[model samples]
Target: MGVGGNFWDLLKPYGHKEGFDFLRNKRVAVDLSFWIVQHENAIKTHVRKPHLRLTFFRTINLFSKFGAFPVFVVDGKPSPLKSQARTARYFRSSGIELASLPVPEEGASAERNSLFSTYVQECVELVQLLGMPVLKARGEAEALCAQLNSEGHVDACLTADSDAFLFGAKCIIKCFCPNSKEPFECYNMSDIEAGLGLKRRHLIAISLLVGNDHDMNGVRGIGLDTALHFVKAFSEDDILNRLCEIGKGNASQFQINIKSEDNIEMDGNSPHKKQLHCSFCGHPGSKRDHMKFSCGYCAKKDDDEGCLRKPEDFKCDCFSCGMNRRQKEQKRLENWHTKICQKIAEEPNFPKDEIIDMYLCNDNGYFSANDGPHTVWGKPNIEMLIDFLNFHQHWDPSYIRRMMFPMMSTIFLRDMASTPAESLLFGQYEFDSLERVKMRYGYQFYVVKWKRAGGNIAFKVPSKESGTQDVAVELDETVNLLDDCDVPEIHQDDECSFLLTDENMDLVGAAFPAEVKRFWQEQELKDLKKRKNSASKSQENESPASSSARSIQLNITEFYTSTKVKHQPKQEESSKNNDSGDSNMKRNESSSSNLPKSVRRRLLFD
Candidate 1:
């Protein structure tokens, strides 16, 4: 979807795995359309309305798991060049023979937008309900995402598009992998520049030489490696300009530093002459001389008879041969570069100005430095979200809330951290107690219990002056249908009974420091008490028996050392059965006939 010729592979070396909290408290711009369409395309056949499902879960994970404030950007009007490229891509992927396939009419070419628009719209709606900000790009979604990042409106762009680098993204998260310990495959422009010496313009130039989303076929003969080699020859500032010049058949003026091995260069006046070599060893000197005094390469201990046999793909290593080889390679590359530049020159539009403009243009006015794109992450519309998912996904409100709890709790904890106070979680559940501390993936969390908030409590008192009963008037407990199946059951005499849930340890420490400290102190006391009790028990066992004159402590096993000795209980039972003239089986059968049918069935199963 970005630069072709396996551009991501070229950048793979620079990408690094980032932890779940890498984007904590940072604003990230997401290529909303690509995020949905690319993923849904993979599992769309097996998963129904995967876009909506993915969007829902992804938003929750990006927000709650990574703690990133995600701003989703949908595509506005795509550029005409992009439209043409997309059409071509669709045709190529349709599995139809291009020559046999009828040339378009609108009906012939399947528009990619038409296929994914409905789903993308549904995703956009779901994201909005989740309370993330959504923006429309002036052209491509990654363009706006990159703009937001470049302008410092967002900390990073969440996109897989390699062209996001060309579009001037400082940092990009390619995507998240659910199965990975470090989920985010993050790329920093600084790392790329430090490692590959490629800046934004250099990447743009590579995209021009290789290929990109908008320009599918770059230079006919050039690929990622060729583009990298060609791009490195020029400075970042003039890289794009050089590409334009090369596309105009002016590459001859561009000086290329093809470093010769050991700084060797052949002068026309001193052309490298082919050297004589030993036929057996493929090294310098005549074969006759080598047979008498072994060649340097062949003699390991200066006593070897024949030269070590040359390998199947061996080449002569003489100085003259190496020099000549370099000369030929230099000439070949010069010719190859010339041919590639000619191919660029032959193309209708060399370095497509629109694409260069698209990448370089920092502000498309839709998102700008003046009044930057809105990246504010708002409070989620819970009710709206419930209704939306219920209608589109057929998910029960209870299920939605359960799924939404992580995101909801995260937001709640943040508020509590800033203004420490007693509050209901999600305005429905109240914090009960901290159950225990749990660890996962090297992260500490507090297992906290939450119970349904009692609307029956927290009521205004009746006025005493009015002669009304002194008790405060109360409202009946609000029975919510959504919570009927999900709400924790309260047992007799226990007001706030509920299951424990894992809460971020850091958030809990900040929001409820006193409680956490108290919990630790109590745990320490309990552990100390346990240790003291065990120590006392051990001392009691080890101490001499009180008031015992001569107590014998004998080991029964030492007294009875014989192995394989059986007890006489079986023989005694046979004698008893013989005396009674009735078997134990008959007695059991009589008792079973009196027992219940259910018990008999249970016995059969047992």
Candidate 2:
């Protein structure tokens, strides 16, 4: 659909996956029609007017979650040359016949075209209501997207078109998948040039040779690989001109190898000459000599039948055979190159000047030197947005409000950053407190909670079952949304919390410096108090234990299962030798005689 040569595939290897934060604070040019068609294809199978739903949600996510200021570009008049390609594509996709009507509403293409264009208008309205800019292109939307990117009016172009590179786009997000952690297949032209060794003109040369949406019949025999090889031979400065020259039967000006077809023969005084081989033995020398006496290579004493006769598919691995094969391949390629050049010469106007001009020209009718369109973001009209979504999408007013809450909060924060004032969020809820910081994938967020002011609950309505009405004592932020999504849900509480992670730390710090300062101050003071208490407790526990100077220390000086020791007195007591040794002996003898029972007999025995 882009450039009929599978151009995106050629550039696929140079692409990288980028996270949502990659577009933070960047101005991106979006091919609005491309996104619409892509979404319609995916969702139209089941959902009614799927383009509406997809465009609505995807725009919200891109603006709020990705934090990008998007300029949506809608298509203008298509190139006259793309009519056939466009019609053919439609037929293939819809399985329609060639007999067609030119009137606006006569055919399937017409009906689809009318419906698609109407939806595109609706999307443009939605984008405007959402505060993003929309620009109409003079030619194709992608061309204008590329123009905006190349002119530095935008940081990147968001489109899946392969020809965006051909149109001089520096960087392109090949696709957008909002749910993925890394939601972009981003490609840079510098990487492609380095990886493929191909420049813009080289790409142009390739598209011109193989085909493009503008010219499906480029050359009869040219293909991607052959065209790639052909284009790389010439530098960018002369590639398009060389193509023009070849188109005008001036291919002889370019160097082409002279093609010759001849079979290999072992002849005298030739560079490729080799010794003749015995056909039956597959070795050096002639068969006649081998028949008379076994050749030296096949001369075996046990049994010799001249190398047991050559196998039917036997191939000689001699040096001459290798040289022969290389020469043949070289000649074949030369022949191929010659035929391709002839085909180029045969086509009338081989390189269409309009197609080349279409790609090479940088003026896309939307850019200017002094007065380009303003790239600044504007304030969204919430009332208008709710009405618009409700009318077109059949969505509830509550659902629309909840979905767009993120965008509104972002706008509010941005305003707070500029004004540096204490203001209610979206003029309805006031900042309650700063919840703890939450981090995901190495990015930090200020979890800020907000509470709706009393008597100002815009979300609260009359009770469903009340004859008159009941007092609204409390309010809940929860609501029933039309679709389940990753948009941060509002919990059932008077207060709601948000992970304000889209902004840089410096911006948020500038916006709410007092809150940030207070949080850090509290954290530091709390940490100090904890440390102080812990130190005091540790000291209190150590004081009583440290008061005692002597410690009853026990030591196990030996290793054994069990041991019994006789009781003994200390050294001080044992060393005391009484001076009255006779007295001590008489005391001990008297105590022993006083021991009872058969005292007389015991004394006699003793």
Q: Which candidate is the best by TM-score?
A: 1
Cα lDDT of model 2 by residue, 1-606, tens digit: 677668788788899988758988799998888777764554454444666666776677677656788999988777656665676666767977646624233222212367778989989998888888899887778888888888889999988888888999999987754335666789999998999999988988898888887777678888888899888767899889988988898878766433233444422223676678888878778878787677766678754454558788977776666666656676666567678788899988778998999999877766575788666678778899878866665555665665676677677677788886777765667655566676644567666655666533344233435321211122122211112233434444544333222344555676778888998898899899999999998887678565442232222333222233322355335546555785588687788777776875777689
| Model 1: pairs clashing at backbone N, Cα or C within 3 Å | none
Which residue runs does candidate 2 get wrong by more than 4 Å?
Answer: 45-48, 93-112, 177-180, 256-333, 456-488, 491-506, 524-606
TM-scores of the candidates are 0.74, 0.70
User: What tens-digit string does per-residue lDDT give for candidate 1 at 45-91?
Assistant: 54346677667777886777667888988887766677767767777
Best by lDDT: 1
Evaluate residue 576 in candidate 2 and report its C-alpha lDDT on the 0 to 100 scale. 62
The superposed Cα distance between candidate 1 and the true structure at residue 65, in angstroms, equals 2.3
Q: What is the lDDT of candidate 2?
A: 0.71
For model 1, where is the 10-residue window of minimal lDDT? 479-488
**Residue 307 lDDT in model 2?**
53
Per-candidate Cα lDDT values, in order, are 0.73, 0.71
